[model samples]
Target: MTQARRNGVLSDATFDDVRRDAWPVVLLPFGATEPHNTHLPYGTDTILGSEVAARVAAHCMAAGTNVMALPAVPFGVNTTQLDLPFTINVMPSTQLALLRDVIRSLEPHGVRALVLLNAHGGNELRALVRELQPSTPIMLAIVNWWQAADHATFEQAGDHAGELETAAIMHVAPHLVAPDRHTWGDGRSNPSTLEGVRRGVAWMPRRWTQATVDTGVGDPRAATAENGAAFVAQAVERITAFCCELAVADPSSLWAPAP
Candidate 1:
């Protein structure tokens, strides 16, 4: 059964009782409502993120562990998609507030730590993480599911709607992909790292209009289900490992620096 996939069934008899074999851990799919090229669905990001969360939760549970995967949070900070129609851009503060509220709401109910399975590249969650550290004092952390897979196996590094994402989408939801959009589109046009791929490097945002014109970055044609399977396997393994690690970590210890 899906961890927290709530049906109309009575709440008391569901997850809290039926799935008592494991500890209460939440796997959240934080996604964005934005454009994902012509071929891909607007919910592609969350779809993948939710897929990862579900698979990872299953893996963890099978290993004699307890975990619950919550339904995905589909709306995120999609400022990059602002110009596009139907692109809902929630403010950072709003996102943070929502997260904080969720954390607080979930904490008292035995939901210890959270695995933030995020998908949107536009959402800047690092600052939100910092802000929540002191308030909730839970074992909270972020995990961008798209980046959890091994890049070497991907045959394409991380980028928007590029090789990795395309392959992943193809793997998870092949029927949703538009073949014409995949075949007709030009090669990935955007430089995902306009400011360079270094911390504190010269910063310049790549405007979606000019940089991501086709609404994609990497080569989608290069994608395949095989690559997506590998990515999913690796991501599930990695995400499960992270979930296990975070399960035992103390929130106070987060402040300590490693040498």
Candidate 2:
């Protein structure tokens, strides 16, 4: 009935008379299934990823970009949180294989590219993308939201499960946020000093137990639903603009400046 479908903003929701080359951009919300301290839900990654992705889709509609938002890939790199009760982790290889299949499916269509709105911090997915570059003609760009849109605000908040995340949960899914359990630890200071942030220069791995030690990071007391709304909205706006720009770019021109 409409010009936009579910995950791929350019799809036809009716699925009737669907043409092979009718879609636009294919957006993916990749997230993790891990704990966010004691207050946030295990679905935090999915919630944030999907919500942000949806916001981007909406923005694209306003921007006149025929992009669609896809359902989120809930399980991310949670190897550290594997020890936690409900957390699950997907291997990088598995993610790569899955992405390859999905990309292949969209390559023949009008889906010009893919925008990965990522919520997890694990960088393994970056490597996975590189592996898929050859077979997948679709341009893929990964936007680690926290890094892409809100790094400044996050560093100001100190750590996770702190102000930023608490506010985000409160704004997106208040029911999942335990207002009473919202607390902070003083061990990892704001912008955690290089010493507190480093495990090993070359390689480092943190056990899930170590994560709970800090539960959530940042200053939850400082978090407010208002800030979350503002930040999430900004992220969506930026993500949409980024996607639109990529949607029309010359694929071979990535080697040079946009100008």
- Cα RMSD, each candidate: 4.1, 4.1
Error of 1 at 19 (Å): 7.5
Clash tally for model 1: 1
Q: Which stretches of candidate 2 lie over 4 Å from their true place?
A: 1-12, 16-21, 151-155, 181-200, 257-259
lDDT of 2: 0.70
lDDT of 2 at 173: 94
Error of 1 at 158 (Å): 5.0
Q: Candidate 2 has what TM-score?
A: 0.84
Deviation (Å) of 124 in candidate 2: 2.7
Q: Which of the numbered candidates is closest to the native, going by highest TM-score? A: 1
- The 0-to-1 C-alpha lDDT of every candidate, in the order given, reads 0.74, 0.70
lDDT of 2 by residue, 33-104 (tens): 776766778888778888787778777767776677777888887666666777788887788888888888
Q: After superposition, how far is residue 243 of candidate 2 from its true place, in Å?
A: 0.8
Residue 166, candidate 1: how far off, in angstroms?
Answer: 0.9
